[model samples]
Target: MDNHDLKEDPRLPYRATSRMEVVDVPTIAFLAATGEGDPNTSPLYADVVEALYASSYGVRAVAIEELGRKHTVAPLEGRWWADDLRVFSARDKDAWHWQMMIAQPPWVTVDVVTAGIERARSRRDLAEGGRVTFTTVTEGLAVQTLHVGPYDAEGPTIARMHDEFMPQHGYRPRGAHHEIYLSDARRTAPERLRTILRQPVEQSEPQS
Candidate 1:
């Protein structure tokens, strides 16, 4: 059987331009783990991400064995927020709360995820695996843009999205700031990395 690829799905937008655009996102499920702190320096972040990947691969293994099919594991994605929205513009990494996840194919249900977690626990140091859960997120109306460069350099683009674009377009931020890592940081140069920056939004009430 041919391996399924999430990137080919229209619901999953892997390619985007630097220009900001509006898109309607459908409800999607993910294997997710939530935590706080600087992703670059926090050990918790590292552990959670490892757990997500391990569980994802485990799910793929289970699928191949039980369903006789396989899928290309999607890229790592994140949802970020903080007590104060300004922290994002200030680049306060330590104050950030985040959920890192890997989107699974629709065929991978809750039972499959549970089985995957169990399998991963037996083979890896997934002290954080228990934190990983199958969750669905409905972004609905959202604005997104492709950000090219280092992770730290994304602040300006994000600011433009939240402070300028949203207001100009009569929308308000409604959910966590989201990011899709399209390039592997380990091998890609900081200047060449590509990321999709997204924010869920709602139409603003008309001024009195």
Candidate 2:
């Protein structure tokens, strides 16, 4: 069986550069869980991530054994926001809201994913698994750039995009901050970690 990987998938713009560029992101389905708190320190965040992976692996098993399909688990992605945008710049993670996700192929139906979650639940007490749901998002137009180094050091790049590039290009932010984790934090060095920073945008109206 062929191994399907998101990194190799042309449909996903997983490859990015330090240069900012505009891209149209198509609607994609995901197994996702939403919560609020610091990803670095929140217990809920850890549980959510564990639940996502467990469920995704479970889904892969069902797909290969029962549906005759096999694929590598996709990268972890997130959409983050806060009641006050300043909280992000201030590094006040406790005030953040986020949705963490793992992509799923079209063939993985909701029922199949549910079964996967059920399998995970049978083995461990992942109450967060119950929060996982099959969902989709359409981020039509967006600007993206590659960010390297520790996740905490992204402020400058993000400020440039939102404060300088967007205004200069007549675009305005439209959605929550999105990030695709391209490097595994568990095995990769923090300074070498790769992440794709994406933000949905819309054309700004001309002032009268």
Candidate 3:
């Protein structure tokens, strides 16, 4: 069976380095679920991840069997923020609010997602099954970089990106902090994990 890999697609900026770079991001669809708390220990976060992957793979199966098209399930992605954004700087993970998602190919529609959810439900019980929704996210202009290390060690890199890089480049944050998980934490060692960190941005106002 032929499989389409979105990660390798040139249209997406899945690649990044330790140095930040600006890029234009296009709109993309995803099967998403929102929750609050630390992903490391949150039961809701785990359920959301299970439901998202189940639905995503179910959609891929539908495409291959019913539509004669095949595609690989994309990596997990997330947008994170908090009621008090300072909580992030303070490393208060329990206070974090996040929308966890998996990118869906163009051919995967609402009907496909619905059918996939039903399929997943029949195969196994998914607590967040009904919560997953197909949605589009357009980040527009953004800056991104690759951080290769434990997630906990990302503070310094993120600090530089937000406090130093953006201002030096005439840009200001415009949206939630984003991350694309390229390596599975369960299987990859923390030091080797590759995560793409992105922040949507806009030109900063000129100083007086």
Model 2 C-alpha lDDT per residue in residues 1-208, reported as the tens digit of each score? 8888867878877789999999998889899999998899989999999999999999999988889998899999999998766566566888889999999987899888988988888988896988999999889899999999999988888888888898999999887989999999999999999999999999999989
Where does candidate 3 have its weakest 10-residue lDDT segment?
82-91
lDDT of each: 0.90, 0.90, 0.90
List, residue by residue over 1-208, the lDDT tens digit for candidate 1: 8998887887666668999999988888899999999999998899999999999999999988888889998899999998887788789999999999899888888888888888899999887888999999889999999999999999999999989999999999998999999899999999999999999999999999
Which of the two, 1 or 3, has more lDDT?
1
The TM-scores of all predictions, comma-separated, are: 0.97, 0.96, 0.97
Worst 10 residues of 2 by lDDT: 83-92
Give candidate 3 misplaced runs (Cα > 4 Å): none
Q: What is the lDDT of candidate 1?
A: 0.90
